[model samples]
Target: MAKIHSHFDHVGSYLRPQALKEAREAFAQGKISKEELLDIQDRLVKELVHHQVENGLEVISDGEFGRSWWHLDFLWELTGFEAYQQEASYKFHGAKTRTTNVRLNGQVAENPNHPFYRDFEYLLSITPAGVTPKVTIPSPSLVIKRDHRSDLYADYYESWTDFLDGLAKAYHDTIQRFYDLGARYVQLDDTTWAYLIQQLETYQDQPEQRRIYEEIAEDDVYVINKALEGLPEDLTVATHICRGNFKSTYLFEGSYQTVAKYLGQLNYDIFFLEYDDERSGDFAPIVDIWNGRDQVELVLGVITSKDPALEDIDAVIDRIQEAAKLIPLKNIGISTQCGFASTEEGNILTEEDEWKKLRLIKTITDQVWG
Candidate 1:
């Protein structure tokens, strides 16, 4: 077991093992009990934590095994939201997800009894000593970005400003709870930053849409920062700007240049950015946001989690050196562009392929940073 002192990390989610997937399906189909399904998830997650340590990872996640979609499950479980089926599923590049999304139904607040609390507890119980247990959930920005609001939102809250205030308070409460639970490393897996940047690009000519998105991005930063204010310095909060990962496909592309103003203002301790392909554009955005700053660390997601073919180690090392010119080598790290699975579908790569990728990241980080 190793203490978490470097940027050698991965986005929290991993490929859900086949047995856990089957157990979830069985429970859905009324073929198994809920307890039985959780038993399977618990067993598989323990194995995942051990697997991660063996691969040289210092931080261990539960692999998001307790739910289906990484963001949706966590959002709907909160106090004032509920899940429902839409007329059509969310369309990804080459795949469409199940027709499920959350809708805000009441005054948004934190549920003192979130299931993730227990799920993270189990992770801590089984995690080997010195390997930091990381608790990951959706960011506060996502509930608003994903359009989980229905007309019913107006019924519970008088104005949009009131709603946002509640959201920030709820997130603050939830994060404080995590700290109390002995969680030092918590990651907010977010797609809102990418969504905002994409929207800015999508509606450049439309003044109204541009203004609306710009406003939303600012509010998003405010909420995240407010939730993170006044926390213990020892708690390391990280965020990932996912560009929609589903079955080896993505929904957003382009650089981080447009959203630098907002990204630079976020209060998180680290940023896990995607640089797996040219679609991520240049590292120029690094300078745009973090120029001359050493208080925060930046982890380059140089490996492609969507693809099984291992990256060339020499090429990867060269790319890292290229980024090091912008930021100090001590404050830089390597990881996959996103998790192996944003949902339970778990990417198109085999589980063995994932281990090889992690090993590559470990080797790259050690050789470059050591």
Candidate 2:
């Protein structure tokens, strides 16, 4: 088996082409057939894969083109989850997102016929040899974190641990399915960790709030570890920590200090952390947790994806070197802080800018790592 490296990685999601978005909307409104919608997705994904290869990236993804929302799309495909438009939208910083909410409708179980299976198959069919095909899905913690009304499902689960166990089993089966389909590198795009950091500010003054935050932090690690159990040794698990990306506006803000100790508890091989700005805080805490671990790698997101402005190469290199002072240089990699498009809306940047950002990552990565 080829050893998977996190060098010059992307967070998986890419900006959706306008035509593809329109086609999806049409399909939702009953104007286009599912086949027609998929055809559009297939074409665009082919182009996206080509772009990734042309950019000199070793790992390629389907650009998550087959779905609308990143987490909701996958969750809704499960046995007992249902997606519905909520009455209110998620209010981000100076931006609003579409009100798509997923609810627990039945018992959660893995659906063997999940559409992402076919999406990955299409991506693998088009990818060239030597380039690894990667698949990104919402971490199991997101499912538990977003279950805002679990109380309503009291009849379904007897306790919180029971609910988490079911979700973990479903994720384990789903991951095994992806692995069987030849996905050696699987990434879990998680924002729940960042949300926990945001809670630090909200509960700093109250002892009870602080206690609850600590409990959730522990639970977050438990859920992720459970989901990762019993996987093949050759399969590489990566996780991308997100601080929210929609229309270029962020949803949460904080440093890793709040969660630094818990970081080592996650069983992922690589961690694609967001450090594009001050909102991500400094890298000292990362150095503290990852100091002696040779099996783990860190892909520091030194480039910003929220805007069109490009970062200076020298400055980015300086930051990377600074991080190396703590973590070993060999275990470090480079990538964007988050995906260019966490949702269908994407960030406030042009397609050209997005490509340039990726190119910039490759450039910086070579200069630093070489």
User: Which is the leading candidate under lDDT?
Assistant: 2
RMSD of each candidate relative to the true structure: 1.9, 1.4
Tally clashing residue pairs in candidate 2: 0
TM-scores of the candidates are: 0.96, 0.97
- Model 2: CA > 4 A from native: 147-149, 289-291
Off by over 4 Å in 1: 1-5, 148-151
Candidate lDDT (C-alpha), each: 0.86, 0.87
> Residue by residue across 1-370, what tens digits does model 1's lDDT show?
2224566899988998889888999999999998898888999998998899999888889999998998889888899899888788776788988888888888888898999999998999998887889988999888775664434667789887888888999988898898898899889988888888788999989999799999888888888898898877788888888888999899888799989878888887788999999888998898756655666788889999999999999999999889888877777888999999989988999999999999988888888877
**Lowest summed-lDDT stretch of 10 residues in model 2?**
145-154
lDDT score for residue 62 of model 2 = 87
Q: What is the C-alpha RMSD, rounded to one decimal, of candidate 2?
A: 1.4
